[model samples]
Target chain A: MQTLNAMPWATNFWLAIAGLLLVTLVAGLWRIWRGPTATDRMLAAQLFGTTGVGILLALSQAMQQVALIDVALVLALLAVIAMVAFVKRMQGPSS
Target chain B: MNLAFDVLLGIALLLCAAGVFYSRDLFRAVVMFIAFGLLLALVWVRLDAPDLALAEAAIGAGLTGVLMIDAVAHLSAKNAHHQGAQFDQTGARPQLWSRILPVFSAVIIFILLLGAIWWRPDAPVSLPDLVAESLPESGVEHPITAVLLNFRSYDTLLEIAVLLVAVVVAMALKPDTSEPEAGNSKDPILHGLSARLVPPMLVVGVYILWAGSYMPGGAFQGGAILAAALVFLKLAGFGIERLADSLLRIGLALGFIVFLTVATSVMIGGRPFLTYPESVAGELIFFIEAMLTFSIGLILFSLFSQAPPPVAPTSSLQGEQDER
Candidate 1:
């Protein structure tokens, strides 16, 4: 952590990762838009669950905001909960 | 290059916002909104506001997404008999002029806001510097926490009161039907997830509350996490909320009650309301914050759990079904 803090290259690497994750996030949006099933659309939020974590992790390093890693942990937790709620509610007492 | 990344992020946010507003399917719009929330959390990070980012991730992206998705599912199930127009209907397309007029007015308002920003003068007061100067006496190391709990604790008290009031109203609005117990996750996978996740979430919630003394984490964020954990356990099939009905009610208002007591007790010492003595101020803030965290968690969970049983899939011969 100290070495990364001292090195300019580390910042660049993390920034590059963040940028790539953003691109991936935007790419995943297509699945939500083109969804022929509700599950397909929900995959977009799952995409956010993973790629968003990666983005926060990268930016935490790039921006020197360690607090964001906690945010990422939280985002991961909540996103999965959201998915669970979706599945449970969608069952609608029939399943 | 940093500027390029920021601009790209801004564009992505705009795209998600547009997707949310324009999506034809209600489910699609809700998904778009969740995506928008993820982007908004990133934007908060970019703005150097980690506290806001944490709150947004917990409440906006996660909880709101679940609530909206729940509502959408309920809507579909409630109107299950109505074919072709249940989830897709935006209630008839608006007249061209009605849509155009709103957009036109929005553009005009946007330009006026831009002009205001362009002409606004620099403030004479530097609030952050003032906060920093008073930091040592404020009892907490984090400026935001210090300000929120010490210099302006009355506002935090009121915020807790507001949360209490919101939950009270939700309780009132809850249908009179005997509430069915949630947290019966018959799914084995959900069972596994809850067992593993809930403990860590509780630890993280307390850790966040502790971190508020020196970092971005605070009662609201920690409380939200605690609530999420309860929500998780409920979803995982635990039946925890029902098991402790009386305790849950007390937990919902305990924070406000404690806060008001502390605020008034200081009057015996000749201090104004909410002014903690400098000697024990830090300990006092932490005590209040811990209670607030628990109360907040319960309050938020009640809001989610008490929602009108999702209008239930009634009207069939199965109208007797209690669970949504």
Candidate 2:
């Protein structure tokens, strides 16, 4: 907590936003917990993907590590591949 | 605030893990597992290791999820008519002793880990400092890349060989059912997405491989991206397996073959197995990484492609079109 107060305001702000993203990320887990349908659960996973990218970007600013942005880039691009796999496999059985 | 974020992230990770463990639905468990991967990547980032975070992000993004989902589909397909529960996973509740025994062992392991951390000894030499000193001769500016591709390249070679063997096993386990794959999907949106994204993924794959020279990227990451693109193509009905059979085997072995060639060829010069002449070390590492990128991509894609279909012929769904 003391470390939070000692930081510059911009870093603090980004860190706070990151915390908020984490909270929403946990919130998305709700849909996963009691998903009425598999597709609904899949949507929650997608939400986690997008928010995960945002969290990385926020942390990059707070930590001032440019490498994190590259992590964010990699996450952003590869995240969709999960959906492709899901759709292809899911469709195989039902349709 | 950073601490706060880390704490919250930790809690989220625990929650996802619990979801995966306790969920009755196999699909839900898999979904929670996917969410867990993203959170884990974040955890890796907070720990200041972008290299691990990159690898986790790549694998967590899709590969494991695809394999597990394929397995779940297989299970359900096999049990399509008989089982009362379609996607429900078995073994939800175990005998009390069975559960308690695992819990007890896990606690013991946790204690041992904490004790190990508490009594950790100071090293005779600082490894990172040693790496920094030798960074110049490493053939790459990036310390991690240097260590992976140059300093400890023997480990890298063996790792590629292991991947080759794994892919080989997957290829053999693949039901020699002859590849018409239950009809390639004709989804227009999927087609559009694949057409647009695959080229960029290929570009990013090569870029990551090239970026290994100076940054937190490498052949593994690049190869993963390449594999993902191939997977995208597979999903979008690219008919990759329909290409040459022998060529696919060659592609799968290329990385290890090239790596071994480099290692043994250097031995004839009477240098240690992987020691490159100072002049060509950088070029040699780059060339090996490029071959690795292509082979690793193919190897990973083979793992996904080789999974037996969820159901046998006459799928649970409609007409089983054997397009081959």
Candidate 3:
């Protein structure tokens, strides 16, 4: 039962995660803007999904709740299905 | 000391994210995104969520990477005419203020949220206490297991339904393309690497599934890893057609059917739904999880490979003739 005062590492981890996620936000926005095609934007969205998972994991640690990790898992799984669906759509009907 | 490590990880993550966005070639961008995913998994590990890290690596990084690469290939093939360096220099000249606004807003929101969390360091106690107290009687030692199965079993059930719905929707959207057409080239290096990688991956996936009872690994993580292996095999042109058979269909349905049957039986026994009899609870849980792994693996691989609905008998004859 470590008190808040003793857990400086958790604070540090959150700060680190926030900074990284900010960069991901910037990059993802850039892709959304400069994407020449629909597929590029979709790829960018997938990147955001990956970053979101990372942020969720970091939050789980800071909150000390393992349930948040399950949310992250579900998010990851959903992201994969979304990516595959988009890819198949882009491929179109193969003659 | 903690701040320094945090800053370092943040910087590393930022660099990778930038690489994913700024790369000119679509293929390069996809590869960088995969690298970013791996780094994100590391951050999750650092954040004390090993189960999430596993899922992130297998599904987020591995499966998503494969899908992105496939998309890139498909897109590149369709638009082969516009080939000379796709990144345009002039397009990069956006107004500075326009770029700055979004960044500023994001930072402000982040700060406000962080301040709120820090201000209330003690999360009001009831939920945490409830979870802690109920864990022992839940038939599982891991807190996540307790949360997922005992306290929030209804949510878990709905989550499975959502997964199945997504599969159905995806299937409806994509026209059938299940047969292994001789389209993609075989890279010797990739083939060699996959052969080396897949066996160990299978072993690890199973170990994760069984060890999940005591640790931060589970059916989802294991299934995602197994899906990755199957996807790898498909990408390398191994047994793609065989995967479209009835066996895979049975594997894909096992989890949902077993779970539904057990849950319904509990209701018939005059207890709440999904409540297992005390004597066979552990065995029942393991059975559900094992079936879940197989079902999830097959479903994801089918989704990735876009395996068409199982061939009609006449279509099988056509497929064989086409193969010949």
Top of the candidates by lDDT: 1
The list of candidate 3 runs beyond 4 A from truth reads A1-95, B21-24, B81-101, B177-179, B184-195, B241-247, B307-324
Question: Which stretches of candidate 1 lie above 4 Å from their native place?
Answer: A1-4, A92-95, B81-85, B179-185, B243-245, B311-324
Full candidate order by lDDT, most accurate first: 1, 2, 3
lDDT of each: 0.82, 0.81, 0.63
Model 2 lDDT per residue over B64-113, tens place = 77777777667666666664543354646667787578668978999999
| Chain A TM-score of prediction number 2 | 0.87
Model 2, residue A44: C-alpha shift (Å): 0.2
Instruction: Compose the digit string of candidate 1's lDDT tens values, residues B55-134.
Output: 88988754788888878867776676565444556588757887678668989999999999999999999999999999
Backbone clash pairs for candidate 2 read none
RMSD, every candidate, angstroms: 4.2, 4.9, 10.3
Q: State the fnat of model 3.
A: 0.02
Candidate 3 residue-wise lDDT, B1-324, digit = tens: 345545666666777676665555555566557656756765775676666777776787557776765665454433443444232222455677866786688799999999998887665668877887977677676677667655686677677667667666666776654454443445465468667767777877787787677667777878887887787666554656465446656776778888888888988889998898776776777788888888888778777766332221111212321232
